[model samples]
Target: IDMLHWMSRAALEMIGRSGLGYSFDSLDEGGKPHPYSVAIKQYLPTVSEFHFCREYVLPKLRQFLPPRVCRLALDFIPYKKLHKLRDVVDVMHQTSIEIFEAKKKAFEEGDRAVRAQLEEGKDIMSILIKANSEAAEGDRLSDEEVIAQVPFRTFTFAGTDTTSNALSRILLLLSTRPKVQDRLRAEIAEAISTYGEDMTYDELVSLPFLDAVCRETLRLYPPASLSSRVARRDVSVPLSTPIKGIDGRKMDSILVPEGTKVYVSILNANRDSTLWGPDSYEWKPERWLSPPPQVLTDARIPGVYSNLMTFFGGGRACIGFKFSQLEMKVVLSTLISQFRFSLSKEIEWKMTGVATPWVKGSSVPKLPLTVELLEAV
Candidate 1:
């Protein structure tokens, strides 16, 4: 089975219902990809092609020209990839507007109309709409702003690819380690036997070995390897220890000028041998079973979760990280308890903004794994 393909579809379906009270795919085998899904898949790659324009040309134009005028200029540029990006944005923007209008109409119609929608009006956008309607006029978001939130599209674009890639990575790892897979399966089976299959949030999160596996996977292979931020003010960032400067003088802090673009390397921080010891390069989920090395704790990496820089940190940290974890844990527990996954074909991972698995020699992302249905435990 091609794990990445199915994982992508599953991520879309999961976010569709929970984020927008909508459904993107039925997830049926051999089903066609949804139009929105195809566009979203194209979005990142298409945008990457315009990095030069975005970083230099667009910023320069924005200083003097209005957004609409800049858009018009882009339309006249006659670039193929630029046109493709415009189409992708159009689809996402239109879809978000449609969903927002439907949600607003439902909110005005009463509770019955709200309850008629999928998720029974419990999805993220539904709650946001309801709250916005009841808020003070000054606190309410404009229609354009609300639509721009694009809760569904944002989650699909941000969460889908990353979560699916992480899931694919974990499955690939599990496929190669039968003993580890069986141990994880056994842990999940025991939890289900004790708590029933419909495990609560607490029950799911409290599973030790399962948590270790996830934390380990994320620590070793963060979906997004880098995050960027612009310094808002001039400040000196203190180093953990003084290092010799280029002038042969000890430097305890480095001055960052305002507006300087800073790139934080999430992957390097997570797998640092100095902090995590020599085994940092190894994939050992068991390392998380106990307290991490004191050096790691003392280093004080400012990650949003579990002392790892996978989610970044501070004001711009990933907002949907907890949801992503719950989604993974739920999927892993259910799937691991019922099926066995083993390696099928050789695979290689490529960095395309996110680390994506592709079968060796193939241009497309694919992770072929042998899946077997397990008899009742």
Candidate 2:
């Protein structure tokens, strides 16, 4: 049950350091939580509760309401969720501003140490700030826009929650399916025997079984279930099989008009019986070992990762797909090599912001696993 929280905290630390140059001290050095960490942790679930606002209302509000007016309304609102969200946003904005100011100061004062950190594209936030300033006049963002862009550096929700939830799913599956877990560990053990446990990026990525496991996991349990898209213009979508309409007419394609909302079902697509054959709904890592069927490949279902809708498709696809995959692979390899996990109790998975798995009736996210030390594969 506790592993979920530990995994979430570990993910928070990983993204905090990788996405930006900040440390949440979430792993090991724990005490009273970092104020930002507390705020950010509470943020997603709160925002998820108000999804209607985010999807349908907030965009409109932002379009219509000025910043001053928005702030005034926030100040006057007595709602609990709104208050929590506002506090989280305040923390994010303040922390980003501080980071931005510190970087600005270091650059202005010509601190060689800070300058060295900025060199060779080591720090993403610094690079972005520098690039924004050096860009052409037309390409340059306004000061307000540039400042506002700081929140995206760490990418608070997506970077932490997305990877964490995906990882949680992977761990839960491994715990329940011991044979599959053993096979994965055996594969890692062989690699460790040759590479001495310090597997390079190339070696980690090259492991076929490991790759298959990740692909299967992501395919079965995507981070996001439904991704909504708004059609920019009237368009027709090609379908592999014709469907009879309500009017009793067979339709091969459906017309999508401009401004129409299209909700892409990532879960259904990944588990589609037609595309992936009868075993599509089953969690079989070996399925990926074979070459993809022509029928599946020929359909040209657009996606960013593994031809699966787990990461969605096209230009707006997940940017951190590789990073998330690497994190999962690394974490799994390290953990499975040392510990064996078995289910402690039944878990109920809820389809929410991150589709968390928790013990029944428990408010907190949890997956109880009886972990034991593994002497060898």
Candidate 3:
């Protein structure tokens, strides 16, 4: 199987059911894929291609040209990527509109039906719709605002390709690292011996080794290697370690101009020797088993998930990080328990925003693994 594609479909269905209160039915091999799923798988790569400009260049354009004019100019240009991105956004907008209308009709069906919908799962759209319906007149979100939460677009994409690639990287690691693979599988098997054939939510969360492996994987191979933020106003940022200025004087702070675009180097920060020790670049899941050094612990980095910027920091941090972790753990445990994986060939990863595995000659994402089904543990 094309594991990257398979992982993408799985993530699409996951975000669909949990965030949109809808089902793409992607895993059903016989059913045709939902259009929204198709759009998302294509949309992400397009966004990544725009990153060359998104950080330093796009903000400059925004200063001179209004967003509307810029978009119109882009439409006029004969760039295939820009046009494809626009079409994808249109598809997402239309889908969100349809989903919003259906949920609104459900609300009109009476309180009981709405409650049933909520009970199915607190899918983001349902919660947003419900909150809007019950809020004071001044507090209610507009229909458009609520619809923007629809899956296969907006925040829900965090759980899609970004997550799929992260999981694939972990899988590739397990296939390549035999000792780590055996230890992880043993941990998974031992934990679920008394529970049943499958690992439960409680068991999945409590397994220490499993948690460490996931965390270490995330730290070493972050799904989003870089993030962009444009300054809204001139501000000074403090540094933990001061740098010397051009005049040969120590500089405690640096001024950032308004509208300046800054790219946060997530991968570099995660692998920094100052924080994670000199061996940080190496993939060693066992590092989590011990306490981190004091110098590392004392310097508090404010990232949302753990101390790493794998999911970023602040208000705009990934909303579905815990959800993604749950999916990864469950998928890893399930897959490893039933099969043995061995690397079939060299797999090169390409960072099109979310890093994905690619072979030298193939455009498609492919990571070949020799798989053998194992008898029940």
Candidate 4:
């Protein structure tokens, strides 16, 4: 089975429900996909066609042109891929507006109306809308700002692909290592026996093997392998250890000029031999099962999670890191408890914002795995 395809659908459904109190996918095999899902699936690949524009042209344009002027200019530009991207953005934006309007109307209609929605008005967007309604007038978000919060577009696009890809990587790793999979399954089974099949958030996240497996997969193969940041001001970043410069002098720090665009290599940082020891490249969940080595701790990796750069760090750290972790753990716990996954085909991971698995020589993203149902643990 191609796990990537199904995982993408599942990820969309998850974010749709939890983030927007909506559903973009039923997740039934061969079911008709939601329009939003269709648009979003096309979004990343289509945008990638214009990587030069997104990385360079757009940035320069934004500095000189108003957003409205730039948006208007797209209509005059006769690029097919650009037009396709515009159409995709339109679909996502329109959907966001519709969802926002519905939620706003429900909020204005009183508690009974709010209680009648799909999520019973408890999803993140609903909670935000409620809070916005009750906040002081000066603190209220504008309609446009609230609409932008709709997961149909921004949240779904940001959270779905990265998460699904990460989950795919974890499953792929487990498939190649049966003993590790069995051990994780046993740990989950024990947890289920103690906490019931439906474990609480605290109980679920507190699982040692499950957490280790996730952290290990994320460390070895971060979905978003690179992150870019512009220095807000000239700053000196201290290195964990001094490095020999071209002059043969030790340099413990580097001065980042103001406004310099820095591309942080998350993959390299996570797998650095110096910081994580020589075996850093290996996938060993047991590493996280114990306290991290002193060198790693003292390295003070700037990432927001587990001293790894998978989620970036500081103020711009991924807002969905916790949510993504919870989602992965829940999916892993449920799937591993009832199914067995084994490698079925040769696959390669390609980096395109998110790392995606593909059958060797195939252009499409896919991960074929042998999955077996477990009658009983």
- Number of the predicted model whose lDDT against the real structure is largest: 4
The lDDT for every candidate, in the order shown, is 0.86, 0.79, 0.81, 0.87
Q: Which candidate is the best by TM-score?
A: 1
By lDDT, the better pick of 3 and 4 is 4
Per-residue CA lDDT of model 2 for 281-354, tens digit only, reads 99998999999877789878899777799888887887778888888888888888899888888889887667
Ordering by lDDT: 4, 1, 3, 2
* True-vs-predicted CA distance for residue 283, candidate 3, Å: 0.3
**Tens digits of lDDT, candidate 3, 80-142:** 888999888778778778877877887777667666786555788777777777899999988
lDDT of 2 at 333: 84
Residue 182 accuracy (lDDT) in model 1: 93
Tens-digit lDDT string for candidate 4 (1-377)? 88887788888899989888888777878797777777766777788788887888898989999999999999999998889999999998898888888878866866475656633566888787778878999999998887776454456788988898899999999999999999999999999999999999999999999999999999999988888999999999887778999999999999999999999999999999988888998999999978998988988888899999999999878888999999999999999999999999999987766788989999787899999999884
Q: Model 2, which residues run further than 4 Å from truth? A: 29-33, 133-139, 142-156
Among all windows of 10 consecutive residues in model 2, the one with the lowest summed lDDT is 148-157
